[model samples]
Target: MRFDELDSKMRIYETAADYCVLPGMYMVARLDGRSFTRLTKDVCQFEAPFDTGFRDLMAETAENLMTCGFRVWYAYSESDEISLLFDRDEQLFGRKLRKYNSTLAAEASAKFSLLLGHVATFDCRISQLPSENLVVDYFRWRNEDAARNALNAYCYWTLRKTGLDEQQATSRTCGLSVSQKNQLLYEHGLNFNDVPAWQKRGIGLYWEEIEKNAQNPLTGESVMARRRRIKRNFDLPMKDQYDGFIQSFFTRSPSRGIS
Candidate 1:
């Protein structure tokens, strides 16, 4: 057949069949010490989320998940939880949902249970977003909500710890908006300069470096595509996609400061 005829036939075949690809909404929940409020204040010297050290810890955790087999996009709720966007079609990932959820939950429980010296557990769920715009807005909403809630909780908790009555503490916390909480972080010698770059880019700010050096742990092949990196992890049990898995920590690049 002529080249043009062959191309025309191929297009018709492509249109008649369904294909699977990555890039969809995923939620990554991390179960760490439930008392992160006190633990964070003790370890980092300030409230959670606003505390740079705590944020760094969360970043490392996200990196860990990315390296394992997930496309982790953003960390949310100021606790140990995160929200991720996967790189596989909904149907493909759905096939392994049970194993994915259980393994992640177990990994989190083991890691944080030891890290925090307390019992911790994680649970995850996946959702497919029909469009890219919704994906971006979803993350923005989750992160902002996490920030606001964490700040308010800390404000009330801090006041109560200082012996303020319940009503007084609640009333006092009402005035501490997210901006004011950020200011307090600054006053306490903490930096709020960067709002997680992972949240913005769906990967860490150092993604370029990661792309440069990351190799598939299972196949020893270089996998440079972000979407493929996410798929490698998702298809891990299948063993066929191992060549595309990429490590999360290639190099640490400074983030571009808040959005």
Candidate 2:
């Protein structure tokens, strides 16, 4: 067989099962840490329930993903998960699902592992939302999840500190309602409402315009110029307010697709 004919015959096997995101649909890539519970608790030994160092690592990894060659409009991170919202018009790799899944997972895993000095891994998947409202709901879902996880974690760790083993703590919190969990924390003198907003609501990353001082080469004069930067929001709104916040991004002018 000719070289071109042989190459074409083999390539079909690789591309036969490939799927792509359709045009006009919103794409959101969610990357989750693999085996992170053991990685953080047993190997890294990070502070239980929540730790600032681990939080920072997650935030940094999310930010890195935003600038790593994709038109990511927003990023949200909580616990060991990161969610990236891409611009609606994004057509990279002709919207290939496997390309996105593999690249993002590799990028996140590589960035996080380098930062932590350990071999951490992330698995990625893309959610194709058909409407803007669905996109808003998607983020709202994750936002509320953060709150639930935070409350449960605080309650679980508190019980653990009070001599409850893992099984005992999980058993105690299994059937507790939201109010009941809050009461549990109150009984331990830790107010769930007083926890850091970032822990409960997750962190958001988006681009913002800021002015910077620059020097004019011709006249040696200083001038203010505007530039876009990734702004980190540790304090995010909740419920209806959060829905409005995500909706607002859709109405903005098309992004320049910068890193």
Candidate 3:
């Protein structure tokens, strides 16, 4: 076969299942650490339940993803997962799902592994939300999930610290209610309410405009210039308040679809 013909034939096999997100749909890419339980607990031996170092690593990885070319409007990181909300008008790679899944996973893996000085990998998937309300609900779901996971982590670790084996600790917390979990931690002299808000609600990142004092190069006159930067929020609100936080990113007028 001719080289061009052969190339075209092989390319079809690679792209046969390619899918693109439709225009006007909100795209949220969620990247989860692969085998992170073993990686963090066994190999890296990070402090169980929560570690400030590990948390910072995840936050930094999310920040890298936000600035790595795509127009990410917001980022949320919790546990071993990072979620990025892309601008509605982002048309990169023709909005192909495979492009996002592959690029984001690779980007996160590379960035995190470099930061941690070990090999860590991440898997990514894109959520295509049809309406603004759904987007708000999606983040709310993750926000609430962070709270649940934080409670369980503290409870599980507390049991482990008090001589409970892995199986025993798991069994102890299995059917416990949220209040029960809080009580368990309270008995251990840890107040769930006193836990860092970032640990419970996760961290949020968004771009903000800030003014900088500068001097004009030619005139040497003082001037104020505005620039955009990624701002990290460790103190995220909860429930309805969080919904308002996510909705704030929708300030831009909605685009009907790709032109």
Candidate 4:
């Protein structure tokens, strides 16, 4: 057969996609901390309670979670709490929320329990929410709670280090808020006031800004150009802004379907 004839019959482009598709806008994950704290405190007798080593451990743990295949960002709260953000568009992520949660929790429990020689125990819960405004607000509220708890925990640990018993530690730190935490730290020569505020938590900015600078998700024109003649404003990125949109689906469990 001639090369040209063979090439014509091969249908080389039939299986190819015309264009690339980007993934989801964002991914949000939260973990419960009450059990984590109890476990850590029981196991480690470090003077500051949640010392640098513990924090590093949590960071490593977050890195492990990232192995599930998403862009990951994490923050710690109250010595034992954590919040995770994942890229929403990764493959199988939407369907794997439960699997991810259960797997993370189980791994934490087993690893911590074993490493700490039964002195500590961990029980955890995980959840994912849409990255819309309402969900952002929810994340803010949750992180704020974590921040407040962190201040309290630090205060209690400080008092305990200064020779107060557990009861006294809790009592002395009662009613302390983030502002108070700053003042207390300032009194002791520390510069920064508090951890990042809960309101400041999560993915810092929205993708709308990025879309504003680039072509529209649907029409593929400058956003301002379209706005000049008609009053049409579309802020969200094109659904397939990234090639891995399937990961966002992991937030939704198969049993629960869409919520």
Candidate 5:
């Protein structure tokens, strides 16, 4: 048999099951770190629950994905996960879910490995939101998760620091409500409300506009021009306020800042 004929036969097994996202769907690619529990806590020894270094690394990695290929409009990160929002009209790789999944996971893993100076991996999945409201709900879900995780972290670490074993610490926080967890931190002289907003609510990355005065070389005239730039927001709002925040980015096109 000819090489080309044999190759055609084998390629079917590789490409036959490929799936593409349907048009008119808003796609959110979420990447989560694999085995990060062991990797961050045991191997790397990042500070328990949260570490500034780890947080910053995660932010940088998320930023990398934004500038990567697709026209990412919004990026959100919390815990060991990242979620990127792409325009509904995006047509990259013919909107193949497999391509987005593989490429994003590979890129995230590679970037993290480079930054950590060790091997790390990320797995990505796509969420096809039918409407823009779902996108807002999706991020609101993550933001709430960050708040819950933050409370659990502070509670867990407080117990651990009090000489409880990991198992004991986990067991103690099992039935605690959000208030109880906050009280736990309070009793330990750590105010949960005073904790950094990024720790409790996650951080948001989106575009903003800046204006600058420019001079026309020939006319010797000055003018104000607007440009778009990506801004990292640590103080994210919540509930309806947050919905309003996300809505502004989608609505306001005339106010983009100078990049």
Candidate 6:
């Protein structure tokens, strides 16, 4: 057998099962911390329920993903998870799902470990959206989840601070409705609504264009150039208000996608 024939045969085996995302559909790569329960509470000993340090680490990791590769239009992070919305026409790795998933997980794991001063792992998955409406709904769903998680965390930590064991705290919050959880916080002199929006709604990162004036070394002439950079938004809105933000991003960029 010839060497070229053998090499071609081996390459087919590796790529035979590779799956690629639809070219015209929007791609969302969501990365979640693996076994974060043990990592946060047992290993790192983050503040009960929520900690600023851990939150900052997640935010920084999200920022790194935003700038890593692919033109991510929006990045959202909450709890131990981050979701990155890639451009509609992204062709990196030929839109290979395996490439996007493994690379993002690797990047997130590396960045998070460096930020936390300890080893951490993130597992990533890709979501394909057929239209813009699904994209809007997807983020709204995550935002609502952030709200629920925030309420439960505060309630659980308060119970723990008041001497309830882990099992008891879990039992106490189990089956509790949203209003019930808010009331539980209020009874303890904590206002759920007063909690920081970022904690409840998650953090968002996207690109923003700014004008930079540059002087040509040869001509010594001042000229304006448009520069694009990542911008983090911690004060994200909820419900219908957030929908507007999604719509704005979709329209803000010049015809980056088809109709």
Winning model by lDDT: 2
Listed per candidate, the RMSD to the true structure in angstroms reads 14.6, 1.6, 2.4, 15.7, 2.8, 2.0
Sort all candidates by TM-score, best to worst: 2, 3, 6, 5, 4, 1
Report the lDDT tens digits of candidate 6 across residue range 180-225. Answer: 9989999999998889888899999888888999987889999987
Which of candidates 1 and 6 is the stronger one according to lDDT? 6
**Comparison by TM-score, 2 against 6, better one:** 2
lDDT of 6 at 9: 92
lDDT of each: 0.47, 0.93, 0.92, 0.46, 0.87, 0.89
Q: lDDT tens digits, residues 9-119, model 5? A: 999999898888898888999999999999998899999778989988898899889878877888999999999988777899999888999999999999989999989
Model 2 alpha-carbon drift over 4 Å, by segment: 217-220, 254-259
Report the candidate with higher TM-score, 1 versus 6. Answer: 6
Which one is best on TM-score?
A: 2
Count clashing residue pairs in model 5: 6
Model 6, residue pairs in steric clash = none
The window of 10 residues in a row where model 1 has the poorest summed lDDT is: 234-243
TM-score of each: 0.49, 0.96, 0.96, 0.50, 0.90, 0.95
User: How many steric overlaps does candidate 4 have?
Assistant: 17
Q: What lDDT would candidate 2 get against the real structure?
A: 0.93
lDDT of 2 by residue, 37-82 (tens): 9999999999989999999999999999988899888999999999
- The residue pairs in collision within model 2 are none
- What is the clash count for each candidate, in the order shown? 3, 0, 0, 17, 6, 0
Model 1 agreement with the true structure over 1-259: per-residue lDDT tens digits: 9999999999897656433334443333433444555555664355533554444455555555655665443333234565544442324344354556666666655665565555545666544456544554555555455545555655555566669887997776566667887775556454444444332222222123123456889999987744322221211111122112121221122322111
